[model samples]
Target: MPGFLSLRTKTTSIVALMVAVTMACGGVMIWNTYRVDRLIEGMVSDSVAAYQAAEALETALVNQKGFMSYYVMDRNPEWLQRLGEYRQLFRMRLERAQGFAGTAEERDTLASIGDAYDLYVAAKDKALGLYINGDEIAGGEAHAGVRDQFFKILDHCEAYKKAHEEELFAARQAVHARAEQLRWVTVAALVFVTGLGGVLTLMLGRQVLAPLRRLAREEAGELALMEPNEVKAVTHRIENLIRSAGEAHTELARSRENLLMAEKMVLVGKLAAGMAHSIRNPMTSVKMRLFSLNRSLPLTREQEEDFQVITREIGQVDTIVQNFLEFSRPPRLAMQLESPSTVVDRVLQLLSHRLRSYEVTVEVKREKPLPNVTCDPEQLKEAFVNFMENACKAMGGGGRIVITERVVSETDGAGLAEISFADTGCGIPEEELEQVFQPFFTTREDGTGLGLPISQRIIENHGGWIDVDSVQGKGTTFVVYLPMDSEEKK
Candidate 1:
């Protein structure tokens, strides 16, 4: 009862079963194709060809014999020439039959025929030579023996023809056997189809209509429910169930919200753990540089540079902490009218050294001048910086990032400043794209996984959204769409 399909799967299965039955019927017919019986066809063809060859051998023999008789009557060399023609014809046909002979016995038969043919030719030539020499009595006597040899050869040919005729009959019988087998196969297929159809009918009646009938009787028994449509009755039942489910859903809605809040807290806690671990590497550098500055107070230029590096690392640590807190309790954006391109330019300049360290290059493409957007430039810069950092991390060692800025006019009397960051790097997997903004999910060991989430929060806080598209091995493109101010839209 738990797994019983509620008409949707059951009905689909019935249709599929019908298709399978149709395919089975087609498969049965396919078995009846001539390709399946090619062996029988080849046998029949070879038998027919060998039989014709034997018949032709006898024909050529007959033609040769009558010509010798005519040559005896007139002593015409033309008759002997014609006789030679028929003899050659017999040899040619015999060779063709030898090629088509399908068995060892047939081969021996052809060989014997050839030997006998050779003897007949030799004897016939001797007799004809005598005739041409004008010794009629001796030539006639020799010719009589030649006729007996010709008869012997003709008998061999007739026997060979008879053997092939039997082969022809056997081939026909084989064809009949195959046809009968196919007929039985077709009968089985029909039986299966008939049985499957019956089963389908029974299932439809008992599984589908019977449930409707039972529901109808239970609901309105009197007068057999006034003969209402079964579908209408079932639909009415489903409607009631759906109404009850709606009520139940209303009861659970608040609890569902509480559960989602709890899930977010758990994710935040996970991100906190990852962030605490990630801050150490930068903080450690900050402490070491501070110790160096304390030892060498009036520091050399290089030491002063180290002090500056410590300051920047401390700032980075503060930014990370600030981003984490901002993600927990999202603050209001400081909306200011500024070109989105300016924010992009600042982020690139800020990240220029980091980009070089990662061996990544950035190419910015602007479509004229971008429209001013109502957004917190700093927050936008933070988001853009995260985007570049993510791209650098994805690139790992060496790659390129192309940042494109443009204005898009919307249908609802608004314009959008679209900043797209396209990275040539190892891309995000398709399955994990949905969770990219979820806290503490990362593809690398040192990743805090807070960067993209904080970036997404900042973008969404300013009434914008981010779209990420990636192919597995190719790369990723992150497009940020922020609506422009009313003045810009006008």
Candidate 2:
């Protein structure tokens, strides 16, 4: 709970949890995959080898059985030679089968078959020897007796083969069972990952986006968003902000100054504007005096440190108070015949260098020059500048801004000039739509959150309004609608 409120800490915790869960799922899947593969390999290698060996034993026993009978019938030495070869082949096959036998039961079965074959072979060999010695009667009698033993050996071979078949079948069933188990594991992991992803998304929305949205609405100047560093959230009052008006923004600052210092000041306008101008001048003078004192005055180390703190505090107060006074002051617009499209061109020209630094591109789309409207050109410029700069800040880098100008006809036959500024940047959430034009709503860190409210006020003063439409991840569009001069309506 020490630094628990920090965004970095919360975000790190959320991301780390998601990563841990993902890695755990992945590890299980990988382990299960390896286990299945090993099972399949072992089943094939062990069961298949035993089955093939059993079949070979059967073939060798059958081959030996007929050769001994043939020797007795043909009364030829060639048949006896073949019978001996078959006997050797049977023995070799029996040994191989014994080696392949995976279980003690299988080994015992093979051993029984071996003993039966040995007895059968002994009798067949004796009969063949008698046949070779030309004792036809005795040889035939002995070979006849060997047939029962031979059949017994055949029976043992068949049983051994059958046992191997059953073992192979059992192995196959085991493989299937393992595969099915793998499927369930996979399904469970998928469900877990999906649920984890949902939780991470919710955490991000609650821990990150909600605070950021609130931060945009509040006028807190600096926030400790993370640690050891201060972040300045932008405060935008669109039509007038001179602090962002350095170098490329100089023209914009001058324009806003003109909009504010118009000659036709009256009533509350005169008083508020007079007060702002009065306070601003004295603050500037005080800042200059403090700077001179800081350099020229010499004192003890402790006194010097105290003086520096006071100076910095005063500077902060001056800046904050000036922004507040200007935010509260009534704007005095120098309204005249001005083409908004042309005003946009000047703002682009003025902010060209700044836009380039952000690697942002702006495109203007219009069928033709828009009809002229009565507006304060300076205020319009400042507002357009705010929109463009906000677009640049929204995208962070390398995005497009499209400005479309057109004329729309109202139901009362009056035409309104529509200027749309669309940006390819992270869009605002729909739930916070109402707050986009609130008094101090800005998306940038370096700007005062006064642009939107001031821009809204400036547009309203010209009998116009601003509309915002945004879709998450796609982009946002800000459309300004202003009444065209009656005579110049398209």
Tell me, by TM-score, which candidate is best: 1
lDDT of 1 by residue, 1-490 (tens): 2346776676667668777877886887676666447857687578888888888877877877678888777777898787778888888888888988889999999899899989988988888788888888988999899889988988988899999999888888877877788788778777877877787778788888888788877864552376578767767767878999998998799688568757876766666567667875567776787877667788788877877787776776766666666666666778888888888888878988999999998989986768787889998888898889888888889999998888787788578888899999989988999889876678887566778988987888888899999987789999999987777866
Q: Each model's C-alpha lDDT?
A: 0.81, 0.77
> TM-scores of all models?
0.47, 0.41
**lDDT of model 1, residue 349:** 85
State the number of backbone clashes in model 2: 15
Instruction: List the candidate 2 regions with Cα displacement exceeding 4 Å.
Output: 1-12, 102-104, 129-141, 201-490
lDDT per residue (tens digit) for residues 1-490 in model 2: 2555686776677678767867886787788778878877887788788788888878877876576566556656787677678778878888888888878888888888877777877787788779878888998899889998878888888888887788778877887887787778778767877776776678778776666556544534433332222123423422124454454478877677556534322333554467568776787788788788878988789988987888777676565555455556746999899788899989999999999999998899989878899999998987898788788888987899999999999899899999999999899988887778754456555555666766877899999999999988878999999999789993
Worst 10 residues of 1 by lDDT: 219-228
In lDDT terms, how accurate is model 2?
A: 0.77
How much RMSD separates candidate 2 from the native structure?
19.7
How far residue 157's Cα lies from its native spot in candidate 1, in Å, is: 45
